[model samples]
Target: MLKLDDANIEAICGQAAQLPSPSLPEVAVIGRSNVGKSSLLNAVLGKRGLLRVSQEPGRTREVIFIRVGTRGYVVDLPGYGFARVPLSVKHAWGRLVEAYLARRARGVMLLLLDIRREEPSPGDMQMVDWFRHYERRFSVVLTKADQIPRGRWKSASDGIARALGLDKDNPPFIVSVKSKEGIDSIRRLLTQGLMAE
Candidate 1:
């Protein structure tokens, strides 16, 4: 993957209500904690540690931004399903995500799923449905591609599509931070998605 220049970041909100205006096309990365979302972001940008990686889930707590050139911005949201975090915190995060999605006029969410885990959690489904309800343009991505066997990937991807209500026409891309698969396609799709509007 080609190196991406360091993105200029600005803190948008402590709570979602305080989020910055949707002045630029924004793409949000969402998933359960430890689903390789941070790793994927770093890998795609050819930078290490741009987004923090945590063994324990729910380490990220805020809606953060990384400017993607002059045309767009990449938003990293707090992860869901971190068992150790307080219920209050989880609820707050949920509200934050919901509000940000609702208010951001130019949001193009990228939902990340784990390939080894074939199905979405109830929370994941809620998020998907939320995006659908808001009529947001989005796509689902399966991360950690290299961990699964090559032959099994087809079945795993198929299962994910079925479970997520995605059709054959709109299948998820299997990606790996370790092997760098599907990074280019994501970059292209993101570029096109952001530039189109």
Candidate 2:
């Protein structure tokens, strides 16, 4: 199993040129603004306050690369949609993220969705489309699973999968940082996937 206890920041890139060279396998975490990406990272890595969590959206304006010992990296990409930032800044972020995704085609992508949201946002659908277009390895992760009743999880998962044009039988991972639900599974999945790469 891959260990994440030794994870450390490797680089913070504002532009594509500054992104670290693809020296190791990587898993990129992506979601809309304030969708609990930072919280999920902290929980999965077994570290608190490692990645800054902000009440305000769009605080993560750059690509953050974190190296996990000698194994690989867990990349934190800027969140898309529902940020209060200016239009120009949002566009810049989009371009930077596009550049990073295009360059790191070999990396795995974990696209998070808020479990409470009944439908996938436009931004979420766009990401799914992009991943499919590039034939990239990606998975959907539903955050804040604790907010909803456990009994409804299956139906919710199936609904979101259908909305995203994914196979309903293969539901997305449902996680909650507070309850520690599915965190270990995600960690193990990332470990196995990155190791195979």
Candidate 3:
């Protein structure tokens, strides 16, 4: 799998209706705010700051699209679990996200989770349920795996899968940007998903 060395970010779509007609297959990166979504993108692409890494949660208001390769597109969706932000702003973003998920063409979605924890909040579960309802192809990937002891990887992944109602046979991968774990697997998965007809 080729690492993202020169992935070029395309346009930032403010509204789902305004999304440019894309020819390539798209893979959406989604997770709670500060779940290392930006960092993970940078790591996968081997480019720092490709996606804006913001300390302030919910800084990414737009849905940014980038070309990963000849046939693949990477979509950085706005983080939805941010708190302490204005309710009006949150509501607007939420509506936009929902519309996109509901209307966009089918594609693969990588839902990120922090490796340190197993259980996610209600909002997280809602996202998973939404994907399931739409019959969308999705996978769970636990980021920051280096933070947890090596022995705990399986247990943590299993717990998360069970909590999310995912089958034990399809558990989330334990990945770490620093350790380079699961990078190859993720790239392969993305490549396959993009190539599938």
lDDT of each: 0.80, 0.86, 0.80
Whichever of 1 and 2 has more lDDT, that candidate is 2
Give the per-residue lDDT of model 1 (tens digit) for 21-125. Answer: 788788788988888887887777667867788787876788888887777777888888877877888889889999888875685788899999868888789
- Give the Å shift of residue 74 in candidate 2: 0.2
Say which candidate scores most in TM-score. Answer: 2
Number of colliding residue pairs in each model? 0, 0, 1
TM-score for predicted model 1 compared with the true structure: 0.93
Indicate which candidate wins on lDDT: 2
Q: Candidate 1: where are CA atoms >4 Å away?
A: 1-6
lDDT of each residue in 61-128, candidate 3, tens digit only? 88888887677678888888777888987787877777767765546888998988759777779889
Instruction: Name the candidate, 1 or 2, with the larger TM-score value.
Output: 2
Worst 10 residues of 2 by lDDT: 98-107
lDDT of 3 at 110: 88
Which run of 10 residues does model 1 get worst, by summed lDDT? 1-10
Residue 197, model 1, lDDT: 69
